[model samples]
Target: MKILANDGIDPIGKKILEDAGFIVDTVHIPQDELINRLNEYDAVTVRSATKLRQALIDACPNIKVIGRGGVGMDNIDVDYARSKGINVVNTPAASSHSVAELVFAHLLNGVRFLYDSNRKMPVEGNSNFGGLKKAYAAGVELQGKVLGVVGFGRIGRETAKIGLALGMKVIYSDLFEGPISLKLNFTAGVEVEVPVEQVELAEIFKQADFISLHVPFTDKPVIGKEEFDLLKDGVGLVNASRGGVIDELALVEALNSGKVSFAGIDVFDNEPTPRQEILTHPKISLTPHIGAATNEAQERIGEELANLLIEGLKK
Candidate 1:
């Protein structure tokens, strides 16, 4: 069987498929030529860089499976692919821990003003060291704070574990209602299990000192004007999940008005080229959508994608 990894796959995953008697090609095929060449491959894999729509699926007569290396399937028209009997799979669990880590990384940076200090201190620290210290002196501690998790999926649960370990009270809200028993593994191999209860969305807005969004992309923004209005004054917000889930304009206004004290965003509504307003804003902490960029996450994602492709195409 012939397979094409358009955006590229990990070497370990490529070897796995090759060892299983499938010919794997890691090539950069332009979108204009993708439709013409897609018919030659039985399976095609991609990360966020590639888009697989109905037109491309219709042109490809030979493709039986499509694999995504990361959690979100926004790049793929999943309903259209499945309608054509194409098996669509993504490694949801693979990047959970990595994304969870990034949430806290941004959260910590925002609360501590580390991003601002690190950038400004290098050039002017020696001359105005004490002034810089006083500027960031109002940073708060995470130990006794309330962390609100918007979505309680794998990534959300993992983030809650970190919050719990740090002694932060965690409150989560999800569409599905159920008790999730979270097992946290510490650095010294100590493990502790905690049962978390679900709460209303209003409670999360009212009670949390810090809020982290983990919702999937949808037509409407979950954190818009109304939701922002609901949040407590001077609340910290973090978004490391999919873009467009949080309303960018509303957030910017909130930041300016002091409704939102600080924000850390890893994803944006317009990727590769983000809006100038949000990117240039001094109050927000920004990253270039690198939630799943860690080495460990990439390895696990590759293995998981390979397994799914094997099951879907080989079996």
Candidate 2:
């Protein structure tokens, strides 16, 4: 069978496919050109860069499967693929640890004032940061802080473990409105309770000292001007979740006025490179959506996606 692996795959994964009697082709094909080339392959694999829409799938009468190399399927048209009888599979576990690590990195940086410190800034007559060192350093100490996680999925669970080890109390808020009984309960100074349902937006803002977000993106912004207004000055809000989850312009305003202590963002509302103003913002600690960009993670994603495609083909 022919497999078109876009965004490429690990050398080991590519070899495995070749040894399995499948011909794998790697090309960073542009989306517009995908329909023309897709019919040549039995399966097509992709990461976020590729958009597998209805039109492209319709062009590929020979294709039987669409493999997603990562967890999020926002780029693929799942409903259309189902109608076409194309098996859709993803590498869900591939980047579990990679994303977890990025969350911890942000938590530490925010707590230790890593983002706010720069003697380099002072050299340019920007004494602002040096003067506000106290405010930045005042960020809640994670060791004893109450880490209120909004979700308890893989990345959320991993982050909770780290918070627990770091001596922070971890409680989560689940949307389904039912209690998730944990293997172990935490009632250390903070109350040990069921993850609150649709936590009063104001409550999250007012109480959380170091609020790190792990929720997925929706069409609307998660934290808007109203949410920002509820926040106690100097509350560190970190977004490792999808972009557009937080209002960027509002965040910038909060940061400038010392309402926000620090912002640790790895994703953006607009990606594959956001606009210049957001990237160069002085108050935000930014990354190029590298939440799952580790070497080991990429390999696992490629292998898992390949397995799904191969298995689907067999059926």
- Each candidate's root-mean-square deviation in Å? 1.4, 4.7
Query: Can you give the TM-score per candidate against the true fold?
Result: 0.96, 0.85
Residue 24 of model 2, lDDT score: 95
Minimum summed lDDT over a 10-residue window in model 2 is located at 191-200
| Candidate 1, run of 10 with poorest lDDT | 178-187
The clash count of every prediction, one per candidate, is 0, 0
Candidate 1 lDDT (Cα, whole model)? 0.90
Q: Give the per-residue lDDT of model 1 (tens digit) for 190-309.
A: 888876667988999999999998988888988888999999999999999888888999999999999999999999999988888899787889899999999899888888888899
Q: Taking the tens digit of each residue's C-alpha lDDT, what string does model 2 give over 1-315? A: 899888778776787788778999997778878888889899888887899888888888899998888677888999889888888888877887688788888878766766655533456335565556545555556777766666567676666666666776666655655344333354675533332224544566667676767777777777888788887778777787788888988888888888987788988877876867677776777777888899999888777776777789989
Q: Tell me, by TM-score, which candidate is best.
A: 1
Highest lDDT, which number? 1
Inter-residue clash pairs, candidate 1: none
The deviation in Å at residue 99 for candidate 1 is: 0.3
Candidate 2 segments whose C-alpha is farther than 4 A from its true place = 116-140, 177-202
Please state the error at residue 291 of candidate 2 in Å.
0.6
How many backbone overlaps does candidate 1 show?
Answer: 0
